[model samples]
Target: MKGEKMMKQNQQDTPLYTGLTRFSQQHPISFHVPGHKNGAIFPELAKNTFRDILSIDMTELTGLDDLHAPTGIIAEAEQLAAAFFAADRTFFLVGGSTVGNLAMILAVCSAGERIIVQRNSHKSIINGLELCGAVPVFIAPEYDQTAGRYTQPSLDTLRQALRKYPDAKGIVLTYPDYFGKAYKMEQMIQLAHTYDIPVLVDEAHGVHFSLGNPFPPSAARLGADMVVQSAHKMAPAMTMTAYLHITGKLVAKDRVAHYLQMLQSSSPSYPLMASLDIARSFLATFSQQDKDKVMTSVKQVRACFGQGNAWQLLPATKLDDPLKLTLHIKQGYTGFQVARYFEQSGIYPELATNTQVLFIHGLQPFGELEQLDNAIKHVNDQLKFVEKHATIEVVNQFPQKLDTLAIPYQQMHLHDIVHVSLHQAVDKVAAEAITPYPPGIPLIMMGERVTVEHIKQIKHLIKQGATFQHPDIINSICIFADE
Candidate 1:
């Protein structure tokens, strides 16, 4: 690896992110909890006298399957989930997929172990790296600079990465990216299994994919060793509701369970658990007519964008989620401006930066193309008032290739990180995670050496108006601890 560094990561052996579950049973003495009191958010429900807010909140008890030990209702619910996603085992998550991801990473990998990760993975992965001190092999996916968006890395790139680091712990891939672009997971899984390594998928925006078609294979079905999904992202489930699934012998269930207990909240949310079950039930009974309606609605929006010379939809090479739509903003209007336009119409997209604007359709009920049609109508009208802005930019389309390194999964002690400027960031040990959010991939990780070109690109992205993990105005980075 270029600029590879020999520094230790400062992350805990397991997870210390169970903040939510830690304060779960904090005796409600009142005068705290933001005073929402849960007493009057709804006059009728609050006054209905089912159970006091304090009484309703309880930890794992009789009839309640312990999240750490799913043998009761949680087990039953998870069984239904296995059927829903067609996985061998499924476990519910209370603190969102982020916690699910932390648990999965910690379970499959130890501190100082190497894992091939997308340069755009979620910040939590970086947190895992810091906690477990894993060495990250960063790979850039297909970045459509013109559109200001990124797609999945090509298979060639991933394979090369494997060849380069045959000892790597495994791989973590994001499905239906922030803007909705997805790689063919089956192929990635097939290649990964050949090496006897696990594949951890961050299916945050893809819970609904397992419900029906037009969407590609969910990670579990594609043979990933472990997969995490954010149910709230596309389900009627409560916020922070999600799940983790195990499908292969390479990943032991007890190992995943121990890590889940270590990283997740012990006093999980009961409502959230019930929501996951109900949402799956809702998804199970959905009609083909409804799926068609969802598809038709999105196609109309794509058609409208095609009408305007300012943008174009990237061609689909495989089965893509009909609800995940990314528009290559053209005519000098960046993803930022287009997102602003959607904002005016009260139509918020899933994500947008200088190059791409993504509109995610999760809930079929609230997802109506007519609303988007109205929004696009307003945008097209506004564009006419600007310059001869119809000229499209050069479309830089790259084939989806990947490179995998022979990185291994290991553990290291936590320490302070050494920081440097963007110019000198490369070749030095990375103390922090430099990443892009909408796609949730890291540009740099814990022990990897940064490069001058990497720094240059980071600066360019900032100048082009891209955002990173900005902890403060003076500091744009927070690195790993020094050895």
Candidate 2:
């Protein structure tokens, strides 16, 4: 009993967590940034509902330390995170991977610099490009027709992009794409380093990759100069929590710190930061038994679907994150169709596309597996053995890559922007990004010309029930008015 107690006590020795625990115990009086004053406004909050969580929803007090200039407990917590992830430095992100991408881009690539970027990069990466006025040199990733998603950029693609944009500042890539398709980042990073260009990886879906070897290698451990992981996406962390890791010396540490100060919230959420620390502490020591339990649940659910099932998982041919389930719907059925059925059966998926539905799993107990098993059975019961093949494969509507440095619209006035329909907007420079939400990559970036191919892809996605953030502009896009 004593030994068990001692072991548990030792595990709770994290820096920021320790400080937060001590601070919360003090029961400091309300007098800070949050108007709620630690749930004072909500009586239910004080009635043991979110007492503990709300208690720690604190601000940068004396010993608590500010997130922007972490010199105390926050610094220690970040240091622990760095050691856990094998990074030189780690920064907690309250605005999620979006802010991390912004900070990373701003840190490594200066304004007016050319940076090679994946065509399927998250919209936040594009926002960083817009903010920094960086010229993006696009590298087309390998597209998977079976999975109906974009996979990793091949070594050849990276090599070609590097050769073409030899003077580019660095490369920004999306690792383990939104559907949990793992990329060969180590080889790609090695190749980029050969050209003396740093590699920034948006590993938003791979925070658990480092927790268990059952998953692919984390980009943070694969020699990427900068790596951003949305801890909330897969780990036991709160939503909007993430980590930015600086793994190599190519990017100056001070520059990243500076950008983080400029980009992150001045009044950062202590709850979010504490959640990151707690999540990291939990993942650092995640038991093998827990991993086996998750694996067992996954296998049990997989077993529910037998051979000849209308919906089978995407083939795990290459290195992929086992925890992410991308189920391919066959025989003229769309992913939206399967996803709707799943929802009807009380099963919710992470994301769905025209041909596939994505389900993300984490270390926490999967209480919904039995419900999913029944859902699968229910779905299979309604399946008709149609003789026709599925015609849901999207047409190759990916537009040609920009041959020259991307023209920046950073200096352009917003009043000069004009909204035009897809057909009329062809050949016109886009004034804003038009992206589909499941995988938030911009189809047409600012200052880039809209094409018929882009229009076709947008129409196809909408036809398949895919929604957009700017629905008003889905049929049309905001573009720069004629000069």
Candidate 3:
């Protein structure tokens, strides 16, 4: 009630931050989850430089409000966010979009229920399935052979999946994928609703889409029941800060909130929650003029590396988000080489695969066009575009229907597993997910049979120096032993 009164008094100000500021003025004594005790415990952090952040790093004391039970400032901050993103309700997330995904899945479907999910979903989504005990009916995302990347899933694919799994509780989508390629989400959502199915979107790379950008509209705006976004990924928010939006009558807000409390930390990070509020305020005040300026800078960066250059920038299609800049390596260098060069020149990219390097911008407060231009010039000056003789392209003979270790009915938990050498693991069900880092898509999902082709692909990636999460102990994989 006191926090509510304070928020009402400062109605024009940022609610969460206003509550934090007022609480800090009280100079309350310590004894909380964080052993730092307002940074007093850490002698090094007690220095002037860290004092500003550490001082305000308070817990959910009186008037500060609890994230799990948001009855005061935290609730008010969520209200502001809901209005900004045009959602029924918005919950601040400190555990990043990963936790948001888990909550959404757990809240939407009960144990043993089925959900149609895209095969290209981030590892978190699969983990969500594991946690919720939901059966995944995987539909392949549209693959771009030229770019060597997975794009959005087509409406037809969703329609087919829905038809096959008519009793499915919901459908999960990874919108504006890691590369920012958004599909016809509005139409897709409409189609899903026609079947009386709720849509849950993993808009992790698409928080800025809702903002005044030329990119396709965010899934939240187009009737998605649940939309999870990593504000830290694109917005001017601290890392691990995110927002989980709930809308429509299909999803119960209370259940989502309850699941969030279960999945998220009991002692949520105040700084992370405050950052969400600040990021929301930042985006709320963004104007059309600001959009134009960011776009102009982005265009200049694109123009700097056009045709006839060693590297070719992937043209932003109508369905693509203009902010995500992907460069396809042409000749004389691989994506890894180009990325290494950029890093050497004090310019790190968002991600780099064997075929392409990605440069993400336009969502943050400032676009790094100047640094990008200099990086491009440096790369150009350092490397020569040498023409290579044409060679025969070897067609990969992928197994048409690689056997899976587990059937649809089998409940494959994340913990039930065994680790075996890759060669011996063939024909065995994967106990743990084997995913690549940059894309984060599983090469072999848990419960799926590890095929010879999968082993060949893993070896190929290893040979190409691709980064795998569990690569230290090479040739070993986690697969469910015969039971």
lDDT, each prediction? 0.66, 0.79, 0.79
Superposition error at 467 for model 1 (Å):
3.6
Better of 1 and 3 by TM-score: 3
The better-scoring model by lDDT among 1 and 2 is: 2
Q: Considering summed lDDT, which 10 consecutive residues are worst modelled in model 1?
A: 7-16
Q: Taking the tens digit of each residue's C-alpha lDDT, what string does model 2 give over 1-483? A: 997666445445577877988987887888776776776665763557776677778888899999988999999888878877879999999999999999999988887789998877899998998888887887777777766666666788778878888898989998888877886678888888888899998999989888746788888888999999999998888999999999767899899889888887799988899888898889877788988888887676555544426677776544677778778777577777778877888888888877778887667556765677788876766555433334446545444443332346445564387778888888777777887786787777777777777777777777778878786865567877863
Q: Between 2 and 3, whose TM-score is larger?
A: 2
Order the candidates by lDDT, highest first. Answer: 2, 3, 1
Q: Which stretches of candidate 2 lie over 4 Å from their true place?
A: 1-12, 43-49, 305-309, 381-392, 399-406, 410-415
**Rank list by TM-score:** 2, 3, 1
All candidates: CA RMSD in angstroms? Answer: 10.4, 3.5, 4.4
Task: Please write out the lDDT profile of model 3 over residues 361-454, one tens digit for every residue.
Answer: 6553345656767877777766665333222121342232112227443455424567789898888877777887978988888777777888
> What's model 3's lDDT at 189?
88
The pairs that clash in candidate 3 are: 431-479
Error of 2 at 333 (Å): 1.6
